[model samples]
Target: MNNAIGNSMYVVIAGAGHVGAHIAEALLEQGHSVAVIESDMKRFENIEAMDVLAIHGNAASPKNLADAGINSANMLVAVTGSDETNIIACVIGKSKGCKTIARLRSPDYLREGVGTGNLDVFGMDLVVSPDVVTANHISRSLLLPSLVESGELSEGQSLIIELRLSEGNPTLRRMLGSIQLPPGAIICSVSRNGQLLLPERVGPLELGDRIILVLDSRMLVANVETAFGVTKGGGTAVGGRLETGIDKIVIVGATKTGIQVAKKLENEKAMIVMDTNTERCQHARDVLEKAIVIHGDATDSALFIDEGLGDASVLVATTKNTDFNMLSCLLAKKRGVTRTMAIVDEPELKLLFEQIGVDMAVSPRMMTVDFILQNILGKQISSTQTTLHGSGITVLEVLVKDTLWMVGKEFGNIKFPRGAFVGSVIRGGKAIKPTRFDTIMPGDRIIMMAPQDSLHKVEKLFSYHSGTWRFR
Candidate 1:
């Protein structure tokens, strides 16, 4: 049976933890029918308050899957703490003819699916690892220190970045059309005083205006920074040069997240990992070749000096302990570390950490939720949609089809919905900065940004033809 809400799917989530609850809430907001199964009584009770079929039982049990309405579920997401339980739930859901996604933490299980291009491993249509996802986020931030937020588009060939205009920015007083941006970069939208302004409507940029930019991934981060007039010296700059110039990198905690971060960066920089547990340090040493592992209290101020954290270019705290991670980053910053990042357990603390001097604060749960939501909705909507942090704007990457109404039409002729801005068009494997005169062609991948409310209108323009909806 189809949901009364248009284009809505029935989704069964196995787990009531942070990731599962967030997923349920997001789906509900999108008008999808949802159900959640949780073994923990407290967690189950908490999720039951939502408008979902809350089944309190082990998600791995077949009876529990049936109780959660797996028979009619369009999707089943298993995000419990136990990897095996998640996998089993996915298998059960898959048998019931539902698309399944599992969140696995073990590297062994992740390697079997993620990056292999075969997400169907263990009967799961998609597999996501929060620790690995969070590690990748931290690695990208460390590698490209200037980006406030970033995501890949056009299959990783293009990148979308958000940067807040700061004082002394060269482009601060320039009209949106007059700024000298990099060759492949296009300013998608500007967030000014809580309003999202399209490029055509934006005036001269002011300090504190957050600008979203879509560009070729190969463009230098330094150039982007220079275009915005971000200086190199003071801690005021949000990002650093693309070349990184990072000589030494220190990671606190030898946990899975920390180890993954070190693993991604060890080959490029002088890597050092510290943890309070000697056993964990030994484990890190055994697995990581280029990293130097040390057992020490990260919160201890003496350890920072003793390990020469003062000379380090970037310090990342990845422990499970939020207090420890915050303390470690703060201490490292005090000792003169150029950049400090922390893995935040609570999403609310991300801003607090940044305000208190942490250069970046990443939440694994949020990252996992984003990944899952993108994958699930991307299939149903025929487009990739991601929301820019704190901005009511969402970036959508849509494939131009021959049946689209705008096909062969100049962008200037198309009456796009208000608050919608087409950023770039990818055709013939190259990203093009589209002008009003550019012609929309079939097979072209159009990247655009629009307000949440305007998304449906934007989609209708592209997906409707001859008074009928033809979604591709």
Candidate 2:
């Protein structure tokens, strides 16, 4: 089996739902062969239009798995809506000597040490949960308050933050090369007017340009906000006197995602969870100790006034209904909520919701795709995280090896491909801000950001093999 992902390999995906179809599309774009097995006729027809072999049958059936060529498949990903089907399909794939990835939603299967840790009971290489991934994304935004989107890298030792240049931002209009950022921070990419620009190619920062930054996780949030001219007060982005903690947060839905969000923030911030379903509300009440669970409609204007929701610093809509989530967020904004977030089922609608008024829109399917892609691409790379909202840029953590060509080269001498940038270097667990004169050393882990097309070149630069590589 090849250890580098730069080469193309055959991949089999089960269930051509949103998650599965998106993963197939991404793999095909990366020059890999793909086949999808979907049980539903409509979904099968939808995915059959793509450049893949589409089979209509139960993914859990061994016959269907055989038809999909699982014996020759390099990897098998099971992302059906049913957890049992996903697990069974993965077991079949694993028995065929194929790498297996399963997307299971039940918390029982997602415990900390079940499939990971010292146990390999699941016979799978990776497992992902859409609810947990989406919940974590929402919680990070609420905790940071100032960042537009945020994610952790290198085992939480580093952070990748996206922030828009507001009107009062100090870095606005400054040349990208001229700004004096914090000691361990670097601008990785900028999204201006719908164009993704590398920091070196970008000129002066403009208003509304979304910039992605890579920095040490220990750096103070306030310092990053100050560097960008964003003011936070009372744990909200609206300027005021600085407070010690987050303000009141209102979540509407009482869903698994909603309950997870409340649980994550219950100890750190005041939480209120509201839903029209009395059973779900009661369930949330039993599960959460600090959150206030209410059995009522969040869209009800009377409930907003009765619960004093206008004082909430943030409002999140996590229901399954897309229109309801958007409407609920708009109502929250009308009630004077400082910021509003919604869970968008359709990835394309994310930008549309943000443009209308929603502060942030997260897609669970997109999150799942990112998680799977990170695992699939982890054969050679140490770790990976992509920018939310489909910016086409990815952050990678790579270990420098003595067998690689650039082991003893200076940062200034190597000609890095276009759209690729080395952000920082970690030597002996300490982050070293990269300079033109710094020398690449063995065992050093380098943090880099690049687009999908340039990944092969980036991988070649750090690959252990001398001539060629394939990762699957």
Candidate 3:
């Protein structure tokens, strides 16, 4: 039995900022008792108003951990702004017999022979770097064709693709069940008019609805786009020409994310970086082998025009300020950059920025939560991935056991639980787009989506144990 299953854990979280606050709320919603410690009194008040047990104090202080009931807590997550404080808090939490996780931004702590795997010596069970997670997500998003935001689904073998509906597509304005998608394609989540939906039996998809699709192989993505006319440059229903793969990449901001993006793309494309801070720009120039560094404000139209932003194939805004990132993307789009991406820290801004024409909006806070949750909830069924914006829907992969009654049974023979359905199946290294007549064989790898609450039910349905294999 999993340690966290059935038992509601006492989870103590340090820091009430964007990442920490969101994690606490999610843990509470999952039936865990949560207490948050924030040094900033104003932030503490904000979190306290949300019904959480918010304490105002230094998390690194033993007295604060005691006040939060660390002695009785099952887990302690330190996501404070200062890495030193987070490390110290974990050390204290460990001494109290709590499982500890620390969230750090600097890579120094993760370097070899440094703070890497040796974290166990310091009482930290896991060290999560949001910067690395955000960087990887941004890199994957850049590789997506037609400007879609893509994430790893099924341990990087499958993908969660976010596509905006283009006009006059056959897949639009029809109930999901009515549409015939390509093999291995599943429409799992929909973001329509600012509402996030886990469509169990969803209605017709609307024009401009941002939909997320799970594909066994990303190669099938172009087929869906072609069938639906969805493209980054628009034109189908969005009313703009489709943008192609990027060649010239322009990044605004010299923060760690910007530097990481520049380094990732420098070898394959012509990279240019712009930042207001001269010292950071110089450091980025020195660190990146071939990237061109420009000392200028991203929000300044004059700077962009002088830099010929219009000629760039892709523009990425990585500044910490959400408003600045939006403005920079707008300027880039106005200057004829076909694709624009922004680094947005807040989840609420993701849809808003996309609505205003930003092609992609990556969030560090959301990335951090997905990592923390996956760690807290160990892999049992298979690998799980968060769809766009950390929507409650998750794509999972599991092996079908021969002992299960459903094995060798037609897909129609089983009734999937609410908010869940099989998306794809892999057998003998070949991917299959499952149909009602398709029979599930033992040892097949099946991909499915379900709400977090329904995951256990889904898992039970796929278990090989004769007791669990029976139809409910």
Using TM-score, give the best candidate's number. 2
Model 3 lDDT tens row, 252-278: 999888888888878978899999888
Ranking by TM-score: 2, 1, 3
| RMSD for each of the candidates | 5.1, 4.4, 6.3
Model 3: ten consecutive residues of lowest lDDT: 463-472
TM-score of each: 0.79, 0.81, 0.74
Ranking by lDDT: 2, 1, 3
87 Cα displacement, candidate 2 (Å) = 1.8
- Pairs that collide in candidate 1 are 145-239, 146-239
lDDT of 1 by residue, 261-338 (tens): 888888988999998898999899999999998888767778767877788888889899999899888877777786
Q: Quote model 3's TM-score.
A: 0.74
Per-candidate local distance difference test: 0.76, 0.77, 0.73
